[model samples]
Structure formats: C-alpha cells, structure tokens
Target: MPLHRIPVTADLIRGALDLETTPDGGLVPHRLPPRARARNTDPQLAAVEVQPSGVRLAFRTRATEVELEVRPTTRVYAAAPPRPPALYDLLVDGTLTAQSAATGGDTLTVDMTTGATELTPGPPGTVRFTGLPARLKDVEIWLPYAQKTELRALRTDAPVEPAAASGRKRWLHHGSSISHGTDAASPTAVWPAVAASLGGVDLLNLGFGGSAMLDPFTARAIRDTPADLITLKVGINIVNADAMRMRAFGPAVHGFLDTIRDGHPDTPILLISPIHCPIHETTPGPGALDLPAFAAGTLRFLATGDPGEAAKGRLTLVTIREALERIVTQRAAEGDKLAYLNGLDLYGPDDKDLPLPDDLHPDTATHRRMGERFAERVWGRDGSLEGF
Candidate 1:
C-alpha cells in the first residue's frame, strides 16, 4: 500500500473539527458533551486552542495565560462538566462563528457543519487536539468565571519554545462568591478579572462561589497551584454558612496558610476579609429564608434592620474583625510571609447603608467598585501589599 499525506491548513482544520476563534483571537471548542461545558448558564464558552508553544486560556481580554509547554507529557486538568449551555463566539481569520456544547468521557467530540470529530479519545488518560491551523501563533481558553482550574500537566508532539521574556507579573487569588463573580454579566467583568486587567498581571482565580469555607482541601489546592502573587478572601462565606466561629476561625486560617506555605515557601499570601453584605455584615451566618415562600417568589430576603443589631451577641462583625486581626498578628509574629487586608477597607459599614434587595450577593456595580477598591488598596503604588 502507498502512503498518503495531507497538508494541514486552517481551512482544512476548520472543516474537520467544531471550533472557532473568540473576539480576542483565541480558539473555542464547541459542541462538546454537556459535562465539559463552561459552568456559566450564560450562553458563552471562552476560547480554547493550541499554539506553537503551548495552550493559552483567558477569562478577560487582558487576562494572563498560564502557558504550558506542549510535550508528549503535557496534560491539562480543568474542572470538567463545566457550567453548561456551552456557547462561544470565535473570530477565525477575522470571521465570526458560534460553537456550542462539550461532552466528556472516554471520548470528547465537537460538532461543526463539516462533521463531528474526535477531540479526546484513545488513551484513557490522554486527550489530543490535532489538525490545527498553521497560522496559529497562540492559543487561548477563556473560562466563564474567575475561578481557578487546575492544569495537571502539558505536553506536545514537539518541543515547546522557550518562555517569553514578558515583564508582567502573575496574581493568584482565592475567595468566595464575590471573587467567583456569581452575578457578573460576563467572565471579563468579574472582580478578579477586572483587577487583573487593571494590574496587568496574570491571574489564577481560586474564587469558588459557596466553596470558600477555609477548607484544608481548598487551601491545599491553592498551595498546589503555581503563582507569583497570592490572595485569599476569607470570613464572608464562613460567616454566611455559619461554618465557624471565633474559636475555629483562627486555627483554620492558620492551618490553611500553613499548608500553602509548605508548597510555596516565600510566596506573598494575602488574606482578604469578607466584603460588605448588609445581611451578614453584623450577623452570624446560616441565615435562612422561608424556602417555600422563596420558591414561590413571594418572599424577599432584605436586610431591613442593622444586621449588627440583629446578630448582637451571637455572630457579630466585631467578632470576625477580631478573629482576622488575631490571625494576621500571630502569623506576622512568626515571620510568616502573609498579609491581611480588612474587608471594610474594600466595602465597609458606610457602604452597607445602601440597600441590597438580595441582601446576599452584590450587584454588578458593587462588584466593580469592590474590584477597584481592591486594586487601589493592594496594587496601588507604595501599597502595603508589596513583596508578599
């Protein structure tokens, strides 16, 4: 039998697989099975692609890429079964196309007008994206939210190019709903994304909505991930979930940091207190709504009175402040490379005076303001958040 070889071109590659370029010149895999979809219910899937050097994924246009040198050993492990209705708009050769949905299993397939093609299959542990466009200079994967996804490994068929000599810094942040951006209109609008854009640094957002409970697993996850600068937003979720009190809060913070420091000995670790929420601001968490009424849409969870007054002696704001203060002071005394930022500085009592209809999450405007405040306080010139 004679051997036949087909020259690979962008058009040919485009014809074979269901993929598209994003507005920011990145490739997005679409028509994937439901499980691998981006979690946001919003009809958008960020771009995912391959570059000569490696793969690049972005959440914001100005977001930084966690480049992995593609080798045979390169394997990226992102949280699968991404929030669904996977939809992405791509910009290929200046042309726009919509790609949708991603499925996961032994085989991952993407659909295009051309046909359905295999994206991942064969080896139980290995997934390959082949037949790429030749003009590919860079590849990017945009996430739907400002949350961190682990890239366990990365490898390519050929040796990857040397690292770029860019002067930009990388910032890794971990937080709860505020940082995860529960209500942001788009991924790019998230606080961490906005801050990363303003600061001109790469970001690894470990912000997980309803998931930042100062858990050891999460802390270990943060420590395991690589970063140049790190920040952890604590207290809000703990208070909201009523996960812990003064007694447990301090030790949890310490243990969390201790785990991270073990992996990143000298990395700058910032501890961020919770942003202002009128309901939980002065109250202890585990607050409940009338489930039945809430479901019926007849009830509203508005913070009518001073939350502090309501919480009085139970789970007061003063208690959270004291707990965080003690943790920072103790860590500082031990010469640990940790820094603490008061949530009030970001959004305090004064801000709380404003009405929050939802009483829990902040509106988009508030999110923007919070991001700006964080940038100013932590990344400002001559800021105390230096050399962490």
Candidate 2:
C-alpha cells in the first residue's frame, strides 16, 4: 500500500506565525512552517518569552495543487531555566493539541480559518510551537516562548498525518507535567498520546506541566472544550506549588468539577491524583527539593514547610488522597457523571524503588507502562470509551 502524501508551498506563511515572550527575553514559535518559501527569507519569524500569552495564525489558500508541510516543531525544550517557571499548552479550535514543559516539545496542526488559538504556560520560561497544516488556504502560527533557544529556521518537506479521522470518539486529558510528558522522548510517545493511539481515539491533551492545580480557569477551559472522554490528572501541581490546603482543596475540586460539568454534562470526567513522588509523599506539608535539572545539570526550587499557613493545606500526599476520596464518594453516590482514579494505582509504592533521576517526572518506559495501565484498567473494559 502506498502512503498518502500532502504537498507543500511558500504562500502558506502570511499571518500563520505566532510568538510568545518569557520573563527572560527569548522567542518561541507556535505555528507550523509553510510548504515552500522564497529562496531566502527569515521564515516569517514570531518570537516570545516567559509570561504566558496567546499567538494566532490564519491562512487562505487558492492553490488546489499545493499541499503543506510544517516542520521542526518548537516549544519549551528545557525543564528548568535558572528561574521559577510556568508551562503552556497549545490549543487549536478550542481543543488542546500539544503542551510544552519547562522541558518539552509539542507540535500542533490545524486547518485554515481564524478561530480562538490559545497558549498558556506555567511560569517563567516555557516554549510552544503550532505546526502548519498539510493543506491550507491561509496559515497562522502562535509562539509562547519564555526562555532562550536558536530557532534555526522553519523548514518543511512533506505532510505528516499519523491517522485519519474515522468518526471515532475523542479522549481529552488535562493534567500536570506528567500528562504534558515532561520526560517523554517525543510527542507521540507521551502516555496520553500512546493511550489514544492504542485505544483508537482522537486526543486533546490539555496537560500544562506545573499548571494543573485545579484552577477554575483551567476547569472552565476544559468545560468549554468538547470531548467524548475526559480525564484530569490533578494533585501533583497543587502539592508541588503548594497552591491550597485540605480545607480549600475539597471545595476547589468541587468547584472545578462544577465548572467543567456546566459544559460537558454527560462526558466521563476522570480525576487522577498525583503519581508517586517519594520526597513529598510522606512529608506533612509544603516542601520543595533540588533535583537534577532538565537543562544540563541541577536546579533548586523554593522548598518551604509552613504548617501554620494556607500553603500547609496544599501540601502533603495524604491531603490529596483524602480530597480525592471525598469527591469520588460524594459524586459516585449521586451517580454523577464523574469518576476517580487513584494516582497510586498508576504509579504506586511498589514502583517507587525505580529511579526517576529527575525526581519529578517519569521516563519513556514508565510513560509507556502508565499508558498501557490506563488503557487496560480505565479505558479497555469501561463502556465510556467503547465507541472510541
């Protein structure tokens, strides 16, 4: 069988380039590259740095004979950049397609026509790239880069389509860095991506590295977006960032879910807690650690242990487990359209001995394992994803 190929051209570059700036002045390209370009040009540059923001790209094409190619995906390529940071997710048509970590790269493709394209990163330094479509009338790119990187130039050769849509249901996931695939080797290798591929479902990954702290804005974002199956990997960020405590965590989660339910009333919403992090798992409250950095070496984050403040409530693994159990119990009784998956079930104490090196994120193999487990335990037998 011959593989289908989409063509490429230069006319796809007009307003299709978007850029975001980080706290430290640096550029991040969000859109995909054009199919072809003039012999010499800067490839229609869009630069960005640190603080999170949005970039847009729109295209109009009249060449029926032309196909498009967007290449060399760009986004936050490093995890720690010598400063506090924020992560971002790239969205196309209100659906999250890719996310960038302090150290991650994702490429998103979209059809032509101006719509809402958003880029939201965690903090400090992160980058996001939006890839060009295989065919287009006009193209637009959005960049949200918060650090530094050498974006040699946008290059494209051919169209790349992993699979064709076949009326299958879609799986949408929103989580912290783990779901954003912090340590995964490639976009396709991320656990969510892997699970989506295996389950034969379309994917809308809203994972935003350190940004999944049960924020109302994020929950509203998820609510506004449409999906057949939805999963939110919560806990890690709330704990790591020390965003809330037990007293507030419960209401916040309820509120977050309430907002999401407003839009996806019938969709299955799976709430996943934090994966195993030995350092903080047993700790009583807010804490941070200096682990091997994502960039060349080691990095340190603010580690504070304050039991007398709001930060204390946000810390602790026990708090997470309690809050999750409360939500699950409350919702399950009413038969509300929501479910819960324990983080330990995904990565438990039995798996803790395995070395992560980074101390925060899992590696590729673990990602694969996690994806398989998610499919087998959550998606395979569940009727919710049967149509997908």
Candidate 3:
C-alpha cells in the first residue's frame, strides 16, 4: 500500500497545554503554555511541561496501518536506574486499539551529585501500528506524557483529516507529577484522562511534574485559557518542594484563584488537596528519595523535614487540606462557583495497601480508582460539578 504523509501540526493535536514549534518543521507539545513557561527558571519544570501527558493526535482515517515519526528526549540520571522507553497508545473510535514504542531518540543525562545535565541528540524513532480496523473511523495517537516527543511526520495507508471538535466541556486541570502521569500505564490511562472520559468532558491537562507550585504564570495561563471547568490539585508539589510557609500558602492560594478568576469569572472550579501521602500527611516536607530503597530496587520517598516544623508554620498535607477547605468555603460564600474535594476521599486510609509503589505517585490501578471516584463525586448526577 502506498503511504500518505500527513503534516503533523497543532491543528491535529489535542489536550496539549501548549505547542512549541521546532526549527526542523516539527512541533513539541508542551503542558505549559509559552507565556507561562517563560517566567520559570527551573529546569525540572521546563523538562516535564514538554512531556505531553494528556496530549494526542486525532484524525479520521480508514487505514489498516498508521505510523508516526517522533523524536523523543529520554531522561537519564547518572546514578539512577535506566528509565523505561516511552509508549504510544493508538485508539480507534475512542477505544484503545494498539500500543507501540520507538527507539533511538535523544538522551538527557543528569548528574545528581553535580546538578549538571547534558543532552546527546539521537535520530528520530518511528511508532507503527498494523491490523487496525480498515473502516473510516476516528483515530487518536496519544503521546507519552512522561517523555518529550517532537512530531516529525505521520503516515497512513489512507489519507487522514483532523477530527472535529467535540461538544463536551473542556476540563482544565492543574496538578503535580501524578496528574502528569508519572507512572500511568499510558497517556490515556492517566487519572485525569480517565476522569475526563467518565465525566464526559474534554481534557486539557496542565499537570506539570514538580512544578505545580502556585506560580503566577501558571495562574495566568489558566486564566487566559478557554475552559468550561477547572480544577487545581494543589499542595503536594508545594509541600514536597517545601516551597512555601503556611502563612504564605493561604495568600498564595488566594492569589492563584484570583488570577484564574480574572478570565474565568464563573467557571466551575474545584480545589483538590493532596491525596494520602503518609510521609507528608503530618510531617512537613522537603521530601527526598529513599536512597536505601533505591539501592534495593524500589523507588520510595521519605519526608526530610522535622515533624515539629508544623509548629513553626511549615506546611504539611494535613495543614494544606485544612487551608484549602477554608479558602474554598470563603470563596464559595462570596458566590464563586467553587467547591472543595478532600484528597482523602479520593485516596484515604482505606487505600493504604494499594500500589502507590513509589510511596508518592499512584500506580495504574490507583489512578483508575481515583478517576472513578472523581467522576462519581464531581460529575455524577447531583454531584458538585452538576451545573456549569
């Protein structure tokens, strides 16, 4: 069969927070918009935003085979174990049909001890899928949210056209690595995607790994975006980074909300506190990787700050929950379409045994549970997100 090359452009992509154009006529999906990204200097933020967790290329085709040429930047840590290769999910008419991965992409090596990083560029990799349904249907190619992918070209046995926009509400969600799909089985299996699917909404995930701190630029991005629904899964990144004190946190939350409200005056906004992270639940953070666990072939995190720091106004998950509840209550009283959902309700004491394997981000199963719960509580009949 003759291959038909389709230009890979933003018009064919969805769920990207932003798209960065490349010099080679390619496009890199970014989870953070450029205006919002220019203000942050953190390399971690820069890297993760470009991972494209919930982004996908959608088109209509009748091809039995599809192929995408991608240039991925695989992250590597000098002392850490080798990271897994990124996966691409192929969906036909909204159902997962196949999955594939590419090889021979760029490698970004980070030296933890010296805090230096280097990038060794490599050749583009091709992700191909065969045996797909040979009838005209909507096809979606979901990029890895955990890897940086630059789209070089797309080809199919049949010609393709962009999928029409759906009528579902646009859900703009901001959170940390878990929402960025750090350990999700695939881009679509991420909690936010699952929840969006169950909730009947279109997803625009802004879950920047390690960078969900209440930055003004992020708020501005949220404010400027056109979203019918918005959710801020706050606290974990702030507490883990030890980025703010309690006294500063409340005001920061208010400022973030105020900025978002500037553009979305009455959008249904949900504030979600951190989920059940035992290490940071009561103990204040600065969380660090458990080096011993790392050496033992398991990845784990441990709180590094003194538990007593809470007395000094240091923030913890517990404190953050309380603060978020209070803030939401006050804002709601002012007639804002705002609501609060305790993270514990999503993942609580009863879920202790579930595989949060890393002791931080939820595993695939936990993500499903969270997504289901979120759908029931926020989008179900008579749920908090019922109207608007």
Candidate 4:
C-alpha cells in the first residue's frame, strides 16, 4: 500500500504547549511554553516537561493502517528492576481502539542512590495501528507518557488532516506525578485522560512528575492558555519535598491562583487538596526513597520529616488540606470562581484495596476510580463545574 508522509506539525498535535525542532528534523513536544522553560533550570523539570505526558497526534482520517515513527527514550533505574516500556494508545472516534509500546529506542539509566545518569542509544522504531475503521473518523494516537518520545514521521495509506474542533470544553489540569500518570497502564489510562474522556472535554495536562512546585512560570503558562475549566491538584509534592512552611504555602497557593485568574477571571477553578497518603497524611516529609528496598528489588518511599514538626507549621497533607479549605472559602466569599475538592474524595483511607504501588503513585485501577469520580463531580448533572 502506498503511504503518505504527514508532516509532524503543531496543528496536528494536542496536549503540548510548544513543539521544538529536534536535531534530526523531528519534533519534540513540550508541556511548558518557551518563555517559562527559559527561566527554570532544574534538570528534573526539564526532563519531565519534555516527556509528552498528555500529548498526542490528533487528526481525522479514513486510513485502515497508520504508522508513527518514534525515537523513544525510556528511563530505567540503574540498580532497580526494569520498568515496561510505555505504551502508545490509539483512539478512534473517542474509543480506545488499539495500543502499542515502543519496540526499540534509547535507554536512560539513573542511579537512584547517587542521581547519576548514563545513556545507551538505540535505533528508532514504529508504532502501527492496523485495521482502523475505513470510514473517515477522528483518530488520536496518545504519546507514551512514560518516555521521552520524538515524532519522526506519521504515515498512512489514507490521507490525514487536522481534526475539526469537537466543541468540547477545554480542561486544563496541573498536578504532580500522580496526575502525570506515572504508573498508568497506558497513555490514555491516566486519570486525567480517563476523566477527559468521560467528561467530554479536551485535556491539556500540565501534570509533571516531581515538579509541580507552584512556580510562577507554570502559573503564567496556565494563565495564558485558554480553558473553559481548570483544576489544580496541590499539596502532595509540597509535602513530599517539604518544599515550604505553612505560612509560605498559603501565599504560594494564592499567588498561583491569582496568576491564573489574571487570564481567566470568570473561569471555574477547582483547588484540590492532596489525596489520602497515609505516610504523609500525619507525617511531614521530604520523602525519601528506600534505597535498601530498591537495592533488594522492591521499590518503596518513606516520609523523613517528623510528625511533631507540624506544631512548628511544617507542612503535611492534613495541614495543607485544612489550609486549602479556609483559603477557598475565603476566596469564594469574595466572589472568586474557585471551588475546592478534597483529593480524598478521589482516593482515601477507604482505598486501601488499591494501594499506591510504589507508595507514591496510583495504580491503573485507582487512576480509573479517580477519573470516574472527578467526572461525576464536575461533569455529572448538578456537578460543581456544570454551570460554568
């Protein structure tokens, strides 16, 4: 069959804030805009921002066979058991019709103990979807959120073009690794993706792994982006990193919301607290990975900060939740369009049946549950986000 090469362009991409040109003429999708990325210099932030968590190639095509050339860079812990290569999800007309994982690509190994890195380069590979519906329909191929994937090319037996707008509400969400879909079964299985599917909204996920620090640049990116509804999942990373004290946390939250409000004054914004994390629920943190556990081939994390530190206003999940409640209530009384959701409503002590696998991120089933609950609360009839 003859294949038509479709140029990898921004017009055909979704969930990426900017598309940077690669050295090999490919395109690298960025979650953060150019100006924002320039000011920040954290290697972790730079790494996750380019991983394409919610990014995808979206178009309308009648192609029975579709192929995407990808240079996928997979991350591995140097001394830990290898993780499965991330999967690519192909959705046809809003349903998950197919899925594929990269067959060959580069590998980036990091020493969890020392934070050193080594790269083993490998050849590029293809993710193909065959026997797609022959009739013209919407096609979305979700990128591997777990890997750094560069789009080399898109080829199909049938022609492809930018998809017509579906008129769905645009939902912008920013959170930490949990929101970034770390342990999600596949790209589209992330909670936000599932929630977007159920809510009938287009998702622009700003969920970066280990990087949602309430930074002003991130807030500005959200500020400039257009969205009908917005949600901020805070507290987990703050507590895990023990990044700040309660006094600083409140103002940081306010400033983050304030920056977004500058661009979306009337947009419905939901400020969500950290979900139930028993380790950090009462205990404060600077979460530390259990190195011995990892060396023993079992991954685990422990909160290092003392619970007694709360008396000194050191942050914890419980402390942040209370502060968020008061903050949102105060803002609402002042006529702000902000609402609050306890992340526990999405996952809590009752969810012990689906415990976070690594003691940090949610598993596939939990992601599904959270997504469903989020949709019901925000998109269901009489949903808090309904009127907006």
Candidate 5:
C-alpha cells in the first residue's frame, strides 16, 4: 500500500507552548513561550527550553506502520564520554507500543572547558514504528526529552486525524533536570510524563535542565498557561548552581509562587522540596563535574561550597526543605489551595538499590520509580490531588 504524507500541523501537537518554524519549514517545539524565550539570555536555558520534554504528536489513526522524519540534534562534549542517542516513543491508545531512534542528523559538539559550540549539519532521518493495532485509536509520538528535534514529515499507511481530547485535567509542572529527563530511558519515561500517564492527566512540562532557576519569566509563563493542576519542584537546581543566599532565596520562592497564583488563584498548587541528594543535603553547591570520573568516561558530581556556608544563609537541600514547608503552611492559612510534598517521598534516602549514578540525577529506573511514587501519593485515593 502506498503511504500518504500527513502535514504535521499545530493541531496534531501537544504539550508545547510554541511551535517555531524551522528554516526548512519543519516545526520545532518550544516548552517556553515566545516572550519567555525573548527574555532569556542564558545559553544553557535557551538550549534546554527547546528540548521538548513532554511534547508529542497526537492524532487518531488506524495505521499499522508510521514514519516520522525528524532532524534530531544531539549534543556531545568534546573529549568527554560519547552519549547514546535519545529515543522516540510511540503510544497507541495511551499504551506504549514501540520505541525507536533516528540514527544520524545534526551533531552539536561543545567544548567543555571553554563555552564554545559547533553544529555540524547533517540530514534528517525517519523513525519508523510498525505492527500497530488495525482499529482506529489515539496515536502519540513522544519526542525525545533532551534532544533538539525539528519534525519534518509524517507518513502513514492509513489516514490520520486530530485525536479526541481525553477530557483529563491538565497538569502543569515545573522542575529541574530530573523532570527534564536527564537520563530517562525514553521520552515517555520522563518522571513527569510517567506520572501524568498513571494519573490520567495531560502534562505540560517546563522542566528545563539546569534552567529551572526560579526566573520571573518562567513564573510568568506558568501563570499564563491554563492548567487544572500545578506542581513546582524547588531547591535542587538552586543548590546545584549555588544561585542564591538565604536572604534572596525566601523572597524568590515567594515571588515565583506569587506570579503563578496571579492567573491560577485557586488552582491546587503542590510545592515539592528537593529529594535525597547526599552531596547537597547539608552542603552548599557550586557543584562541579567530577573531572576524574569524566575523564574515565563516567559522569559524577561534587559539591565545592563549604558546609558551614549554611550558617551564613547559604541554602542547602536541608534548609530549602524547611523553608518550603513553612511557605506552604503560611499560604494555606490564607485559604490558598496549596499543598506541600517533601520530594524525598518520591525518591528518598532509603532507595539505595536504585542509585543516582551522577551523585545528582536519577537513572532511568529511578525515574520510573519516582513517577510511580508520585502517582500513588498525589493521585491515589485520599491523596493530595484526589479530593482537591
């Protein structure tokens, strides 16, 4: 049977706030809005913002075989360990059915010591998924989390149309690399995506890697997006960057939440503190890549700031957790529909079997574990999000 090409339009896209038209007329999904992108100056944040953490192509089709032509640009550090290619996940009727990857496209090489970047242009490749069920069903092709992808074309054996909305509550989430899917197994394996699936909710993930720094623009973007539920995972990134001291941290958190509340005054907001990170539990950050480990083709992290800095108002995971609890408590008194969750409940100290390989980010298995725990706690019966 001859395959018919379908124009990948905005109606078939989900979870992206903006769709940037590529030079080739392809579409690049952006988790951030145009105004938010315009406001950002940090290159790190800019790169991660277009990573398409929870972005996917959604439609209804009876196709048994489908092909998606995408220009996937994967980044690699010169003189560092070679990274594996990110995966594309296909879901039929809300269940994961197949996983594959586009082998070659563009390669972005970064000079680690110097902040230099080189993009070696390459051809766009197609990711093909076959053996899908014959009956008409909802189909979703989840783009890789960290890889920058520009979708060019979609081809299928059978015709496709806009998928019916699930009528589920939209869960808007913002967090650090863990939620951005630093080392997740696949796109759908990202903790936020996983939890969204289990909870039967739509996800709008603004989990930028090393970029969830409590910026005003991020808060404004969240405030502007319509969502039935919201979650803010704070602390780890602040500790990682050693971005602020106690004097600024408190006000910053308040300001971030305040902006989100401006648009969603009564939306149930869950503020989650940092999970178990031994390096930053009591120590201040300015964390550095473990050079020796990196040289040996292994990635690890080490905190450089002094533990005593906490006395001088330097924030740590320990201190941040206490502050978050207090903030939620104070807000609740004012009749804010707010709740607090110690992120440790999602991935705590006791889960020694599932280790965070880098001393920072969770591994793929840990990501799934965290998602399962999150679903049980926040979406289960008598849960924080259940009755609210």
Candidate 6:
C-alpha cells in the first residue's frame, strides 16, 4: 500500500523532557532540558537521559492503521548479559491498543570491564499498527523507555492532527531510573505514567535515569515549568551516586524545594523517599553493577559501602527517609504546601513475592502496583494532595 508519510517533527511529540533534532531528519527525545544538559558532563547521563522514559508522540486521526519509521540506538553490553529488545507502544484514546518493535537501528556496545564503548550504525526499521476504529480519536505512540530512539516518519491511512488539549492537571515528576521507567513494559507503563492515568493528570516526567541528583539546574528547570502539582522521588540516586553526606542531603533537599517554590509558591509538592532497596536500606552506597550476575545474562546491583558508615553520616535509604520526613515536617510547619511520603508506601515489605529482578529496578508488575498505590495515596479524594 502506498502510505502517506508524515515527517516526525517536534510538534507531533509530547511528554518528552526535551526534543533534539537529528541530522538525518529525525527527532530524539531527551529527559533533561538543554540548560540542565550542559551542566551534567557525565557520558552515562547523556545516554540514559535520552531514553524516552515517559515520552510519546500524540496525534488525532481517523485512520484504522498507523505506522512509524524509527531509528533506535540500542545498547549492547560486552562481557555482560544481553538486554531485551526495545518496544514501542500504541495507545488510542488513552487505552493501550497495540505494541511494535523494530528489527534494527544503531548498536552501541560497551565493555563494562574495560570502560570502553563502540558504536555500530544500523538503518531505521518500521513499526505498524492496523485495525483501528476509523473514527477521529486521540492516538499516541510511546517510544521505548530503555532505548534512545530517533523518530524518522509517521504514516496513517487518514490525516493526522495534534491531539486536543486534555485540560488535565499538570503533574511534574522528578526521580531516579525507577521513576524513569526501568524494566517497564513500555513508556506508558512507567509507574509515573500509570499513576497519572489513574489520577487523571498530565505527566511531565523528568525522571532522568541516573542523573536525578539534586542539581541546581534541575531545580531551576522545575521552577520554570508550569505545574499544578509536583513530586520529587529522591535519595536513591544520591545514595547510588555517593553524591553527599547526611548534612549535605538535608540542605540540598531544602534548596531544591526552595527553588521550585520560587515559581510555584503554593503548588503542592510531594517529597518521596527511596523505596525498599534491600542492599541500600542499611548498607550505604556507592552501589556497583554486579559484574558476575551481569556476565551471566542478568543485571544485578550491589551496595559496596560499609553498613557502619551510617553512623558516620553516610546516607542509606533508611537514614535518607528519616531525614526527608523531618525536613518536610519542618517545612510544612512553615505553611508550605509540601508533604512527605515514604517510598515504601508505593513498594515495600509486603511485595517480597514480587522481587525486583535486577535487585535494583522494579519489575513490570511492581511498576503497576506502585502506580496504583501512588494514585490512591496522593491523588485520591482524601489523599495527601487533596486540596492541591
């Protein structure tokens, strides 16, 4: 069939933290804004922050069939286990209708042991969805959460237009990789996305995979972005990065909140502590990738810091949660519309049966559970964010 080709331009995409034009007439989704991008020089951050965690392309169409040409950069870990194939999700009128995966694109191979990287180029692959209703309705193509994608083109049987404004509450969220959709089935299945769907909110997910440090640039970006509600899922990234001590963490949290408040003085802000991470619960981090497990084709994480270090002010999930609760309490006393929620409330002790496969990121089922819990606890009628 001769299909009508629509260029994949920035106007067609939404939920992206940032959009970058590719030299080859394509668009790449980035989870970090340009200003924040310049401040973080880590190559790892550069790669993962562009993984399209909650990013999706939205349009209105009456077409019964749709297709997209994508140029993806798939990562390959040398001396480590192979990763799963990336997937693209199709949603029609807010309902997940179909999913597709391309065969090839670019391959980035990394030798974790040697700290070396190599890129092997590949061509774009096509993804198609057929048998739609034909009535004009909202359509969304959610890119892979674990792969960096360069969208080349879109095709539909009928004309496509931008989706109408949902007029939903804007919920701006910032967190680590887990919130960035690690191990999620698709971009739309990310915990935050799930929560947003259940809570009836528009999500601006700033969940940078490994770059959710309390950077001033990030704070400024959040402050500038208009939002009805805001949430910061902190601690895990700081601990995993070994970025700060207890003293520094408290002040940094305060500063991050203060920056956001500069623009959204009364916007409801929720501070979420780290979820249950056995390794980092008592043991301090810097966590390391478990090479042995990785070599065996399974990704695993191990906290390397001494448990005794907690007494010395080194941060652990437990210690960080305590600190966060205290800070939020003190701030709330000052009349700030801020609240604290322990991450475990979303994923915790009772979830032992649903183990996090990598011992770091939650599994698909866990993501769904967390999302449902979050929506009920924060956005529900009598929830913490009730008035906001």
In order of appearance, the predictions have TM-scores of 0.59, 0.60, 0.96, 0.97, 0.97, 0.96
lDDT of 4 at 203: 95
Ranking by lDDT: 5, 4, 3, 6, 2, 1
TM-score between candidate 3 and the true structure? 0.96
Query: Candidate 6 has what TM-score?
Result: 0.96
Q: Write the residue-wise lDDT of candidate 1 on 1-388 in tens digits.
A: 2212222113322101134443433233232222323343322122221111111232112112122211121122232223233222222222222232222313334332222445443321222333334443333333334221222233333322322333567677877767766656545556776676567676666565565666665566567666778898887666665666566677778898899898899988788777666666665667555345455553334322335443343454457776777888788889887778888787776885544445666666777777888888778865435534
Q: By the TM-score metric, which is better: model 1 or model 3?
A: 3
TM for candidate 5 is 0.97
lDDT of 3 by residue, 123-172 (tens): 99899999998889999999988889999899889988899987878999
lDDT of 2 by residue, 1-388 (tens): 2223332222321112234333443343332222211221221112211111222222343222222122223332234343223333333333445555434333222211222233433322224343534453232232222222322222223333222234767677877668766666655557886687567676666666566666555566567676888888888777776667688788888898889899988888788888877666756435454443323455434335543443445467756876797897799788777777888777777885555656678877888888888887776765355422
- State model 6's lDDT: 0.87
Report lDDT (CA) for all predictions. Answer: 0.51, 0.53, 0.88, 0.91, 0.91, 0.87
Question: Stretches of candidate 3 above 4 Å error?
Answer: 112-114, 381-384
Shift of residue 21 alpha carbon in model 3, Å: 2.1
- Clash number for model 5? 0
What lDDT would candidate 5 get against the real structure? 0.91
Instruction: Write the number of the candidate with greater lDDT, choosing between 2 and 4.
Output: 4
Scanning candidate 2 in windows of ten residues, the lowest lDDT window is 43-52
lDDT at residue 327 of model 4 (Cα atoms): 96
> Which residue ranges in model 1 land beyond 4 Å of their true spot?
1-141, 146-167, 290-314, 352-357, 382-388
Residue-level lDDT of model 4, residues 321-344, one tens digit each, is 999999999999999988899999
What lDDT is obtained when candidate 3 is compared to the true structure?
0.88
Worst 10 residues of 4 by lDDT: 379-388
